[model samples]
Target: MKRIAALFPGQASQYKGMGRDFYLQYQSVRDIFNRASEVIDKDVYSICQDEKMLQRTEYAQIGIMVLCIAIFDVVKREIESPIQFFAGHSIGEYAALTCSECLNFEDAVKLVQIRGTVMGKFGGEGKFAMANMGSASNDVIMEECIRFSDDIDFVSLSCDNSKEQKIVAGSSKAVKRLVEGTEDLFHGKVINNLGAFHTNYMLEAQKEFNETLCHAKFHEMKKVVFSNVTGRPYFDETQVYPLLGRQMVKTVKWRQTMDYLKKMNIDEYWEVGPGCVLTNILKREDPSINVKSADKILKMEGTGNEKIC
Candidate 1:
């Protein structure tokens, strides 16, 4: 039997037309979107269909998670293989939890709405994220963090795309300084994110989230799901609430998470979100393992190659 893996995308993978196909093709998917709209009090369907909605972080957050979950639901109903393990990047962890049945759909949507509100309140404009820096040791990254700590306040290591590649985050000014300072160290690229995340700057938001999660209820997971904060399996439903609260303030260990999946003997990695960001990372880390993205899978029309719709 194939050891299938499910991947979820984080904030950046969202787009205007992401879930429209699913909404048009399946009633179940349409119902999920409708439910999200009611719980979040936002028109998620319009948000997913409109380019203007992409500008708002709160709407984008809910949009990405809903799309990710909706896509996973579709794939689960269609695929016959038994899923071995589940994981998600950053915010995608919540999506994995919903998939694993650790959190109910309505609660997850409400939590994410609250999460987006708190995150926005604490992390204002001028905060940013950067991507595509060559992999340096934690010490090396820390040293750079220290040099710019006056301004940058290093937040988190977003993703470990490969042994030689990783993404860094900080405030916009500080990130700019780091990029200017390390131009010689990194020859690749440093693309910025929508805002500052996975850093101490978001502590206030985390505090609010801690209170919110403390009172929330979680169900025992039906399948093993990994945490972005710990890069380990979620053993108890109680621990999930706190882990999420601390996740914003902690660096994401994407490399370690993938390592754990490799240890679990994951035969194939399937990215069940709108984009293939995680799939790209898996390929760079180990190209031999099968990596498939839901977008590619759904777009294929009885052919192995991706098709345009």
Candidate 2:
């Protein structure tokens, strides 16, 4: 038997009508969306259908969580297999927690709603921006950013997605400067969002989010879940809140997380979410790993039921 891990994606994975097929096909999926709507007091179905709503941080966060959870639910119902581990990227962590029964769906939705609002409001206060640096070594990117730090107040690494891909977030002027300075050496593109996440720029939001986490209830994980902050399996449930809080203002150790998974000898990975972002990253990090999007699995197996399992 193969040990399967469930991977969830965070921001930048949401798309208009992302879960519409599942929403229409599965009562379980519809029930999840309905629950999400009741928890957030917003029409999740409509939100997923609207491009503008999918772009707002708050809406996007909740929308993606709901979709990921719905997909997970569908997979659980259809597959007779056991998931050995669960993990998520950034906001996707909430979905991972929910899937592992660490956090209830309603609590996860409400928490992410608050998180998105705080991050967006604080992130928009300044001209902060994020950019993807492709074909650049992490050391080279860091060196360039440091070289320009005198002019920029908040510029740092946001995510180390792979050996060759890194994300930087900071003042738009600083990011643009870095891009222009390294145009000949590396390819870079600005990410669509106002916040410079995983950096000190999110300290204010992190504080508020921590307070929110204090009141949030967490249950013992039923399955091992990796932390983006530590890039390791969470051994202590008590550390969940603090790790989630720190994740806001810390670089996402995604590259390390993938390495950890590889060490675990995970036989396969299922990206249980709206987009194939994490799937692509996993393939880039380790081509030998057997990974597939939940939707892709359904299609390849000729399941005919548009649901993921």
Give the winner by lDDT. 2
Instruction: Quote each prediction's TM-score.
Output: 0.91, 0.92
Q: Write the per-residue lDDT of candidate 1 for residues 175-194, one digit (tens) a residue.
A: 77677788898653667556
| Candidate 2 per-residue C-alpha lDDT over 1-309 given as tens digits, one digit per residue, 9 for 90 to 100 | 778889999898988878877887788889989998998789988998999888788788888988899889877766667887888999988999999999988999889999999988888834778888885777788898887666446578899888877999988888888777778877788875557888888889999888888899889777899899998889867879888879999889888888888888888889998889998887876678798786433443565534353
- In terms of lDDT, the poorest run of 10 residues in model 1 is 300-309
**Candidate 2 residue runs with Cα over 4 Å from true position:** 295-309
Q: lDDT values of the candidates?
A: 0.77, 0.84
Q: Alpha-carbon error at 159 in model 1, in Å?
A: 4.0
Error of 2 at 290 (Å): 1.3
Model 1 residue runs over 4 Å out of place are 151-158, 296-309
Error at 181, model 1, angstroms: 1.1
In candidate 1, list every pair of residues with a backbone clash: 129-193, 135-164, 135-165
